[model samples]
Target: MSRIILHAGMHKTGTSSIQAMLNSNRDSLRNNDWEYVFLPKDAKAAYGYIHSSPDSCTYSEAKKELEGIISGSDCKNFIFSSEDMTAALQSEDLWVSKGERVSQLFESLGNIEVLIYYRRQDSFYESAFQQRAKEGVPLNFKETLKRLPIMSSMDWYSKFKFFESCFSDSKFTYISYEKAYGGIGITGSFLKYASLNDIIPIDHSKSDNASSKILTKIFAEYGPILDPHDQSLLSDVLCEYERAGDFRRYRLLSLEDRLSVFENYYQSNRNLYSICENADVVDLDIWRADLLNEYSNDYRNAVDDKDIIIDLLKLISATQK
Candidate 1:
């Protein structure tokens, strides 16, 4: 019997890193007897289908692409990874009912397993806010953080009951971004399920790209520090910056500030975390601490020297390359 694994992302959870590694090591994965089907421009294809279909939330075009992949390949195991799936769930109204869509999609596949990763609400909201700013959304961190409910509403488990209803406990797994690297046993368990085993080398290269809380604060306060003409170029480079887990310069809110923010979303955030805990999702305490540590370290090591600006400029230039 064939196996189909669908890795639907909850976003801000190292999705890009995983996707990049998979795409970069496709040959190795194939040699290990696994067939990987990655849409060259998965986001474009996903958005194309989403925007084009006014009546359906399901990306029929993307689904068609999946159909072609399944039909064209004879591999017994197939993997489909995309963070957009989580977005789709969040905007459930845009798609047909969740139950209907899941049933229809799964009917076309063999035995299927669903995987997702969850991040802490506070951390995800902060990072997502920075990301929105980079994308031309003129939202400051405060405004972005204030919109947590709207954002968290889109997470897969939060919006779609179909995923839980359709798949057994054993068929679904949730991982935390905190345990994402090294010879981590958590990652080992995840890979074991995919049957990738030890055939693939662990990716030790730290993510150079990923939103830095400090950098985000800097941009928020000073406006685009990079050359305006290079905004587009810098945006490209910063795309991966979110994965770097580099949080040097970002200061955590004071106890009062943290309490205030938590109070604002007390019920909602609690419920969200509760759902994750119930679903066996790994907690993100470790990751949150790591982010804070990086932020503090960056702030301390930050220099007001011209060399720092020069380095930033160089990073922008590299993005254009």
Candidate 2:
């Protein structure tokens, strides 16, 4: 019997953590009849076996390698994960490119089960901004989003719907990150999702924590503003920093602004979960109420008036166009 579990992530949803667990616990999981299968060394690392830039020759070779692993192993369960599959965007038509990746993947792997986690819109935007900063986009939350419309679109329902059309046969299980946190936590929830809670131990000792590298990307992006010597020295200092850090994690968008974005996805999210439009899975209403009660007009955030001014200028420039 052969079984495949594809954990395609919707960025910023603890994907690196889940992939780390799979990489570290491979042997232990193999003992439990579960295998974290391999693709090309680069593909396994950067993207789930699905390549970012797809080619038939590369995917074909990978398919051969994967089939060999499946043939030799007695394990009934296999996992391959890379959430950036649907998350990352380079152009307006991400679906065509990513959808091609999925099509190539299905052609290679044959019948397989796919699992994806859908994160709420507002939280996804905040966390994704941090990720973009890692890739050396130093703009603030609002600006980065303005540049990346696919991200700002917050169109999870349409993306997932496309996935359904692409891999319609595979068993689909949707995990709510908010719901998962309130219950068995991330790793625990994954094990439960895989039905391996009793089989494989949830060990995260060696999980990859890539957050530390954000400073390097940020400094690199600011290279034009720094001298060569200063840039090198800054890199050294950033690497040794005692703690993980990102752009000051302050409120980037106003609550009213965030709510407006959330409204775009309200019906989409409800459609995904088969819940009523008024029901909140992302807890926006609850989070909004609590935040409003905690902070007053006197509460100042780290976002500077200058940054707000820049945002306004950008908006003004856009409207004129």
Candidate 3:
């Protein structure tokens, strides 16, 4: 009857850092009566069955798969983390059924706690697009936005209600990515929330999750032409610049556009706040102010080819040293 904690990352909410931190401290965490289950093979397939198609697999079979995966773990508690779970929940045709399946899949494990971190709608939209762009999706930012399933993804209230209803007997914790993660940083905030006091020093300098705005732009414009090898080199060059603090801010959304994102999801956000007892009107207002200030100056700022060439030369010279 060990407790089960699931970190269901609603993407672009610092999930990578959190996962990296957990893995780095896995042994220490295990020593402290908690086990972090790494899922990329067998467990991922098992999770996908429950997350994508509810009626595809029986609850008993799913439970057996999970139990088998963690067979040797002697920890008092278990943690499963995956951001892809949020993608399944964002599918318009599958969210509700998936939610029910997810609940049922874990029903055998007593005292299940589902933890989710949600970013602001506007920020979430932009971040998600940027992620696709970084992966060399050749579409421009605006076109990318056109293809996102915004209604299903941004309707936080509806999703929250579905999750609450499905997990009626379990605990569901919803956290605001912007408002909730204070100065302690996302990884620190997560550990705090999970009630873990282990002080595992993470070297943020080498974090792989930090995306380069310059790299995103280059990929968006030239991804189709560049082969895998070229793309990898380009990424390395861009990342070098990013690490040296020489990259410029890239914002494809205008101030007006970002504001409109919030406006479009305004009512849903309010309704979401109604259910979340810790949410406050002041937090909403502050979030708006932060968004406005952050996006006011950067809108479709083009990267200069000459500057990139110069930086590329600089990188090559340094490498030759």
Predicted structure with the largest lDDT when compared to the true one: 3
Better of 1 and 3 by lDDT: 3
Candidate achieving higher TM-score, 1 or 3: 3
For all candidates, the clash counts are 16, 1, 0
* TM-score, structure 1 vs. true: 0.66
Ranking by TM-score: 3, 2, 1
TM-score to true structure, per model: 0.66, 0.70, 0.79
Record all residue pairs in model 3 with backbone atoms less than 3 Å apart, i.e. clashing.
Answer: none
| Candidate 3, position 319, lDDT | 60
Tens-digit lDDT track of model 2 for 150-208? 57566666666677777766777777776665566677779887888777665434333
lDDT of 3 at 318: 73
Runs of candidate 2 with Cα error greater than 4 angstroms are 38-62, 87-94, 100-104, 107-111, 134-137, 202-249, 275-291, 294-321
Comparing 2 and 3 by TM-score, which wins?
3
TM-score of 3: 0.79
- Model 2 poorest 10 in a row by lDDT: 240-249
lDDT of each: 0.57, 0.60, 0.70
Alpha-carbon shift of residue 140 in model 1 (angstroms) = 1.9
Per-residue CA lDDT of model 3 for 1-321, tens digit only, reads 888888878778888888888988988998888888754344754675766544445566667788775666788788888776556565656766777766776777657888888877767777777777665555666667777665335788887777778888888888778765554677876787788845465332433433365566666666556677666666667666667765556655667787788778787877877677654334557868987676555453644657676667577567647
